[model samples]
Target chain A: MGGATFKGGVHPDYRKELTASLAITAMPAPAKVVIPLQQHIGAPCEALVQVGDTVKLGQKIGESKGFVSAPVHASVSGTVVAIGPYNHPLGRKVEAITIESDGQDTWHEDIKPHGSLESLSPEEIKAIIREAGLVGMGGATFPAHVKLAPPPEKPIDTVIINGAECEPYLTADHRLMLEKPNELVFGLKIMLKALGASVGIIGIENNKPDALRVMRQAVEGEANISVVALPTKYPQGAEKMLIYATTRRKVPSGGLPMDVGVVNHNVGTAVAMCEALHKGKPLVERVVTVTGEGVARPANLMVRIGTLVSEVLKACGGLKETTRKLIIGGPMMGLAQTSADIPVIKGTSGILALTEENVDLSEPSTCIKCAKCVGACPVNLVPTFIAQAAEHELIQRAEKLHAADCIECGCCSFICPSRIPLTQWIRLAKADILERRRQQQK
Target chain B: MQVLYAVAALGGIGILFGVLLALVARFFAVQSDPRVEAVREVLPGANCGACGYAGCTNFAEAVVGGEAKIDGCIPGGSETAKEIAALLGQEAIETVPLVATVFCIGDNRMAKDLFVYDGIQDCAVAMKYANGFKACTYGCLGLGNCVRACPFEAITIGPGGLPVVDKEKCNGCGLCAKACPRNIIQILPKGTAGHLVLCASHDRGKSVTLACEVGCMACKACVKACPQEAITMQDNLAVIDLEKCDDCGECVAACKPGTIHPRRNLPVAAPRPQDQVAV
Candidate 1:
C-alpha cells in the first residue's frame, strides 16, 4: 500500500542482528533495587513507602499527585532499605527508594486476570492504564493517560503504533513483534478503544521484515487496523515523523500529535496496555535488549523495573574485560550512565555495553558546515545552526533556529563528519531556552 | 489637453487610495501598553532568557503588568536593572554583579597525568573514561568547555591548560558555570577589588597536597591568619567572605601552599626582603 511518509531523513547502519535472533528470556532478580521517583517527564512521584516498609511486587510504592505525573510501583517483594537521595542515570542525585529483595516473587492481592478490553469503558481503560503505572515506554515516559485524553475541542481520529526501533543495537520491539504478535495487536485495539479512534496503523521499519509479516498476519481479519512497512530510517517513530508517515499530517511547531487529530503509542506501550486491561497487571517488567561487543552474552530479557543496571550486566554473563562505556538505552539517544547503581526505568529499551574499540570516542572537530545534519533531519531543522548557537551561548538565537523542536534523535551528531557533540549542545540550548521561557512567566 | 486629462485622472485615483489606506490604519490601530514599551526600551535587548521569558519584550510586558520583578535579569548586571527600575518608576534594587570564576588552580604543574587522552577533547567525553587524564578526578579536564560556552569570548585556555577569564570582556553571564562538567566554574560577586577564593577542591590536607600542588587542603591557616577574620571553612573548603576582605593580601601571604592567590592582574603588594623585613 502507498502509505504517507515525511521528508528528509537518513538511513543509519542497523546493527540489530546482535540481539534480534535472541528470544526474550526472564533475567534473574537482583538482591537490591533502586527505583527513582522522577523517572517520567513530569512532576516526581511522592514516596508512599519509607525505609523498612515492606512492599509487594506490583504494589504502588510512589503515588502521582499531579496531572502530568505517573505512579511508581515496586518491581519485587522487598523491604525498603532506604528512601532518600540516590544516584540517578542522569548523573545527579534524586530521591529513590532502595529495596532489598525478599526473594519471593509475590504479587499484591489486588492484581488478578480480568476478562477482556470490550468489558471496559474509555474511563475504565484509562484508569486501568494509570493504575498499571504505564508511561509512554517510548523513551519519553510521558503519562499514557494524558495522551489518551486529548482536549475536548481537538478530536483524535487515528492511533499510530510505532514499531520503528530505528536506533542502532536495539531490537526489543522487533522481538516482541516476532514472538508475541497477538499481544501487540491486542494492545493496539485497547489503545484505539480508549482513544475512541476509528483507525489504527502499525508503522514498522522495512528492515524488520519478519516483524512486518507476523504483525500483518495478526491484523489480516481486522478491517479498521492495518500494518504499514516504512522505509528504513532513523526517527521514523518520532511523533511528527510517524504522523506524517501514516496520515500525511504535519503537527505544527510546539504542537502535539493530537493537534492534527492523531495519537501514537510505542509497540511496547501497546502490549503493556493490553496486559493492563486483560491481565489486571501493572507495568512492572519490560523487555530489554542487552547487546554489544563489550557484553559476554547478547540477548533480550524480560527485566523487572528498578533493578540495578549492574545486576543486568551480571545476568548477561558480566561484561568483557575491555568494556569502556555503559549506556542505558540505544547508542544514538541513550544517556551514558556514570554509575551502574542506577535502576532501569519504563523508557529504557536496552542496556548497551560497548568496549573502547566499539564506542565512537573520536575527538570533536570544528563544524565544516557540510549540512549533513540538515540533510539527515526528518523535521527539516538546521542542527548545525542550533549547535553553533549553543556553542556561542546564544540560546535565544538557537531557539529562533528551532532548537526546541529538536526531537534529539541524534541524527545530526551521528551523520556529522566533524564528530561534533551537536546533539548534546542542542539539548543544553533547548534546556536553557525552556528555562528562560519559564522564568519570564514568573 | 489629453495629457492634462490623464494626469488629473491618475491624481484622483491616488487620492482615493490614500484616503482608504488612512481609514484602514485608523480603524485597526492597536493600543499598546505604554508601560510595557517604556520598560522594553531600557532592557539590554540580549533576550538571553535568563529572566525566564522568551525575549526582552515579554519580560517588559510582565514587568509592566506587575507579574514580574525588575531585578530578574542576571546577564544585564546592576546597570540594566537600574535602567529597568527607572523605566518602571520604581526604586532601583542593588543587584550583585556576578562574574564567572574558575575554582581550580591545578594547572600543568600542580596535577599529575593519568593516560594521554587521545579521544574526544570535551571534558564530558573525557569524564566518561576513568575520571579524565588527571590524577585528581575533580581537577579541570582542560577541554575548554567553559571557553566554548562563553558567549562574549570572555574565557580562554591558558598555556598551563586552565581557563583564564578576561574580566574586562566578561558580561557576568553564568553560562560558563552551567557548561563546566566538574561544576568548578562559579558565579561570584564582582567585588570592589574582585577578591575571591581560587581553590575549588574539597579534599583533605594530605590527599589534596598529593593530588595537586595548589588544591585547598582545608588547613584553616588562612582563616586564622586573616586580620579581618573573613575566611570560613564550609564543606571542607576555605571561602573568603568578599564583604569582609580588605584586600590586604594577608591571606595570600598566609596560604603556605599558595591556594589563595590574588585575582589575575590585581596589583599585589611587593613582599619585603628577609633582611629588610626585620622590624
Candidate 2:
C-alpha cells in the first residue's frame, strides 16, 4: 500500500547509507563469550552449566522458571571459565556464563531440523520458539514466545513483521531485508501460523525501496500476506506505532499490540525463528551493523551473540582517533556505553562509535516554556510537567500527569530547544511511580 | 452627597459578603477529632515521611483515626510518641533514631576515572552515562545529587567530593536514598557505638583494586575478626546486621583499607597510645 505513518515522531537523519548497500559478512567468533543470563526483560535465568564444565554449542547454559523468561544457550562449543557477574551492555553487572571457546565450532547432536510448518501445531511451534530462546532482535529483547501466546480473550488476528528499522544508523534489518527476504517472509508465516492469524503484513520504511521491492517479490504469491510501505519516521517501528501505521489500530494506553488484535516481530527475529524451526538452530548469532563516521569500515556483519563489542569494533577497523561516544543501538535512543568490555547480547542491533563531531556532549540548559516537547511526544503525555514534577520530587503531581504512560522513546529530549533531558526525567518519574505503587501494594 | 451614597452602597455589599462567607464556612468545615490537633501540637513538624505518611498533619490525622500507631513520628523519637500516646490513650513504642549515610568510600581522588563524563548535573542522568562516571560502578559519583535532594540541608559535598551526612540534622526521611542513582545512601540506626562499612563495591579483588583503592575486596577480614558475629559476607560484600552488633571496634581494626568506619568522635582507643606504651 501507500505510505502509512504514525503521529508525533521526529525526522531524525537516517544515516543508513553507511551500511545499507553492504552485504552481511560473518565476523570470526572471539575466543571467549560472556552470555548474560538476563538477556531478555524478565526474571534472570538460573545457570544450568557451571564453571569448568565443557558445554557443547547450542547446549542450554541457563534456564528460567518464569514463563516470561527464555533459556540461554552457548553460542560456541567451549569450556565454561566462569559463571559470575559480568559487565552487561545494559549498564549493570549481571550473572553471565563466560566460556572459552575451543575453536572447534562443534554443533550439538540434538540440533536437528523440525521439518515443515504444516506438521507442527501452534502449541508445538511456540514450544520450539521458546526452546530456541528467540527474542525481539530489534533492540527490545522481549521474549518471542510470550508475544506469540496472547491471552485467549485477546486473540491476535494479524501478525506484522517489523522491517521498518526506523532507528537511525542501524541497517542490520535493512541488510536482512535485502539478502534474505525469503527467510523474512517465511519467518512471518511461521509466526502467523503460530499465532493462528490469517493475515500477515510486512511493514517497511519507504526509505528502503530496494528492501520493499525484494520483500514484495518474496511474498507476491501469498494472498494472505502483503507488503506495506511506511513513511520514514522515528518510532514507526515501535510496536504500537507500527500497529497504528499499518492497520490503523491504536494500541490503548498501558496496553500491548495484542490488545488491538495484532502481533509484531522484528525482521531479524523472524529470520531467527525460521532458523530455529526449519534448520534446528538456536539464536546464537545476529546481523549487527557496525557503522559510523568514527569507524574505518562501515558494514553489517553477522556476529556471534556473546562476542565482545571490542572484537566487532576491531573487525570494523577499530574506532577513529577522535572517537568519543560508543552507542549500542542508535544515537537517538541507544545507550552511551562507558566501556567496550561488554559482550554483544541478543538485543545489540548496531554498534556505533561517534567521533567528537558526531556527538554533541553539551550540558542541558533551563527549559523556556517552549512546549516543543509536548507536541513531539509520541505518547502525547505532557513531558515538561512530568519532568518538573520529577525534578522537584513531587510524586503525587507526576502521578496525576500520568508519568507511568511514558514510552521513553526520547522524542522529547531530541526535540527540546533548551536541550533539557526531559525523557530521562520522565523515565525516572515512571520508575518512582511504579515503585510507589509497589510499596503501597506491600 | 454622591460620595456618601456610593460609600453606603459598598458597605451594604461588604456586609452581605461577610454573612455569606460565614454560612459557607459553617457548611464546608470538616468535623475532625479534637485529638488530631493535640497530636499535631506534639509532632516534630519536619514532615519527613519517616512514618510513611504525607506530612506531620497527615500523620496526626492517621494517629487520631486509629490508622497509625502513636509512635510513627520517627524524628520525634520516643518523647513525642509518649505525648501522642497519652493523648490517644495508647502505649508509647520505643524507636531508634535513624540517620542517612553515604555507603561509597571511593571518592574523587581514589576512584579510577574511565572517561571524562561532563553530562547533566543530575546523578540519575549521569548514571545513564554508562552506570556512572566512577570506574568503580558501585561507588558514588560525588556530584552532590544528595545535597540537592535533602529537604533539611543535612547533606553536603565534603572536600573529598563525597556526600557527607550531618547525622544531627538528618531525620531519615529516605529522600536522599530516593535521589541516589547508585543507591549508596542508606538509612541506618543512629548510634555512636555502631560501625558502618563505607564502601558499596562488590567487585572481585582484582577489579576492585583496579577501580578503587578503598573498595571492599570481599576479603572477609572483618567477618573473621568480628567477635559479636554481626558482620556477614553477602553477595561478595560485607553486610553488617546491626541488631547483633554491640559497637565493638574489633572489625574496624581488622579492616586494612580502613573501609570499616567505627563511630567517630568516640574514645574508641580506650587508652591512649602514649599512655599505654610511652608512659
Candidate 3:
C-alpha cells in the first residue's frame, strides 16, 4: 500500500490515550462469576454442569453440539450456584452458569499443556485451539477455529493479526501488543503453520507507535512474520479493511476474507492462542479497557470471563455519578448496556461509561440529503437511501441496494448532519434482508 | 422584387429542414408492441407504485412484456383487472383487497409506562431508550410512529394514546406496520365485517397482567370458543388464523379482556364504484 488505505471511512476522535499507556493489571476474581453459555456467534452452548456441581477452573462447563460453535469453560474453581437465565452483555437474558468462588482458582485435571508449537502437527494445533474455545476476541466473537479452517479450494497464504484497535477509548489490544509481543508473534507463527500460510503480518494503527515498535522487535528474526503500521482510522481493523490495508486484497461483496486467500485474527486472540497452546490455559480471561469520562479511574485490566461488568467497574474505582451511558465495547460499535449486572463475555474489549458531556442525546431530525454518511461508509453504501427504504418498509429495495454488506461501523450515524439514526435504520434493514435470505434458503 | 427573393430563400430552406427533421424522427423512432399501448390506455394511471413497479405506464409495459399480472393494481380494483384480462384474452383473477389494522389494544388506561417518556415523539427514536418506556416491551409505545408513517393519513393518535386506523382511508401499503417499532400493526384482508384479536403483546401472562389489562393472558377462552379452531397460543399470545376466521364473532364474546372485538363501524354502505375499465 500506497496512500490509499480504504475508500469511504470516517476518522473519529481517537480517544485511546486515556488508557493506552496503562499496563494490563490482573483484576482479582470476584466472589461470583456468571458465565453465559453462548459467547461466540454460533450456537449457544448447553450447560454441561448442573447447579450445585463443584467445578474446577478451566473445566468445560458448557458444550455445544454444533460444529460451528465453541465450548465455554469455568473461569473460577467453585460450585455452580445457578444454572438458569442471566443478563447477557448483548441486552438479553441468556442461559448462564453462575459459580461462587471457593477461593482456590484450581485447575482441572484435564487442563494439560499441548506440546511445543513447532513439535505439534497442524491438526493438533487446530484441535488445541478448538478445545480452548478461542474466538476472534475482537468484538465480532466469531469462533477462531472456524476462521482457520478454510475450504480445500481456497488456499490461504497470509494471516494478519489485527492490532489496529481503531475504536475510540479501547486500549485492550494495544496493551496486549506492548506487554506480550513475542507471545503474539509466536501465536502468529502457529497460525501460519496451521493455515500453511507463507506470511503472517501484524497490523497496528500508527497511533500506537510503541506497540508497533515492540511488536516489530518481537518479530525481528521471524522468517514468515512482520508488523505493519496502518493509518489510524475508524473501522480500519474491520476484517475486510485490514486485509485490504495489509495484503491489497479487496474482499469481494458478500464474500469472506478466506474467499480472497487470506485470514485475519485479533492481537488478543493471538495471545490467547499462545496461552491455550503453550500453558494449556483455556480462554477464561481477557484484557478489558475500562475507560471514559464517567469512570473515576481509567484502567486496563485482565478481566476473567463471566465476571460481572459491575465488579470490573468497581475495581476501576466505580462509575462517576454523571455516567449516562454504559457500553460493553468501544463507543463506535459497542452494544449499549442497560445494566452493569450483565457479565463480561469473551467478546468484550472495553466497558465505557460515558457521561452526559461525552454523549449526544439530542433529537434526530429528517435527513437533509447531506451525502456525508454516503461518503463515510466504508462499504460504499448510501446510508440515507437504505434508512429511508427501511423507514418505508421497502426492504426488497434496500436488499437490492446491498444492505447486507454493511459492516455496521456507525459512521453514517456519526456523520449525519441532521442527527438521523441512519446506521440504526440500516441495521434494521440488514436484519430484514438476512431474514428474507434465510427464508429463501429454506 | 426584394419580397420575392426573401420568400423564395426562406421557403427553400424550410422545405429542406422539414425533410431532414422527418427523416431523423423516423430513424430514431422506437419499435414498441401495440399491446403495450393498449394496456397503457386501459390503466387508471394512479401511479401509486403499489404494484411494485414504477408508474402506471411502466406497469402497463411490464404487463405487456409478461412481467406483471393483470390484477396487480389495488386502487383500480376488480373492474380494472377484468378489463386488462379481457384485453389480454385472459380470465379475470379474483383477489381480495386488504387494509391496515392496529394490533395493540393497550391504551393509556390499559397499559403502564416505566417512566414519563418526554423524548422524541417517534416510536423508533423512543425504542433506543431502554427498549422504550413501556413496561410491556411488546405493547405499543403510543408515540404514533404509524400515524406519521401513514401516507394516506388513515391512522390517528386517539385520546387513549393508541393509533386508530380509519379503514376507509387506508390503502394497505404496509408502511405503518413497518414503522411500528413494536410491530403492533398488521395488514389484513379487508371485509365489511370481521372479528380479530386487538392485542399483539407476547409478554407472559403474569408480566402482561402487571403491565397491561388489555393484553392476551393466554387463558385460551377464545381458542375454546372458536368452533373452527382459528385461534392458537403462541409465545403466550393468542394468534388468529384469518383463513379460518369466518367473522363468526363467538371469540369476541369469549374474550374477557375485550382483547378481541367485532368491527365496530360496520360498512353498510356499498363499496366505491370501480373505475371504468377500457377493453
User: What are the root-mean-square deviations of the candidates from the true structure over C-alphas?
Assistant: 11.0, 9.0, 9.3
Clashing residue pairs in candidate 3 (N, C-alpha, C atoms within 3 angstroms):
none
Give the Cα-based TM-score of candidate 2 against the true structure.
Answer: 0.76
* Per-residue C-alpha lDDT of model 3 across residues B78-163, encoded as one tens digit per residue: 88888888888775333556788888777766777765443346788777666787788888887888888887899888766788
| C-alpha lDDT of all candidate models, in order | 0.83, 0.87, 0.86
Q: What fraction of native interface contacts is shared by candidate 3?
A: 0.08
lDDT of 2 by residue, A310-416 (tens): 98888889988988888899888788787899999999999998888877767688888888888887777889999999988999999999999888888888898
Model 1 Cα lDDT, one tens digit per residue, A1-442: 5355676777777778899999999988778888899888888999999888999988988987798888988889989999898877766778999889999978988888766777789888888888888998878898988899998899999999999888889999999899888988899888888889999999998988899999999999999999988878877878888878877888999899899999999989999988887778898889999988888999899998888888898898998988877888888888776557788889889999888787666678888999999998887889989988987679889988989988888888888999987887888889899999999998
- Candidate 3 backbone clash number: 0
lDDT (tens digit, per residue) of candidate 2 on B1-279:
999989989988988998999999999987777888889999989989999999999999998988997678899999998888888875432266778878876766667777767545777777776667778889888788889989899998876668888888998878999989888998877876678887888788778889987788888999999998999998888988777878888988988777888656421212223432210
lDDT of 2 at B5: 86
The parts of candidate 3 lying over 4 Å away from their true place are: A1-4, B1-133, B143-145, B148-152, B158-161, B164-279
Error of 3 at A157 (Å): 1.8
DockQ, candidate 3, vs. native dimer: 0.11
Q: Which run of 10 residues does model 1 chain B get worst, by summed lDDT?
A: B270-279
TM-scores of chain A across candidates: 0.96, 0.98, 0.98
- Name the 10 consecutive residues with the lowest summed lDDT in model 2 chain B: B266-275
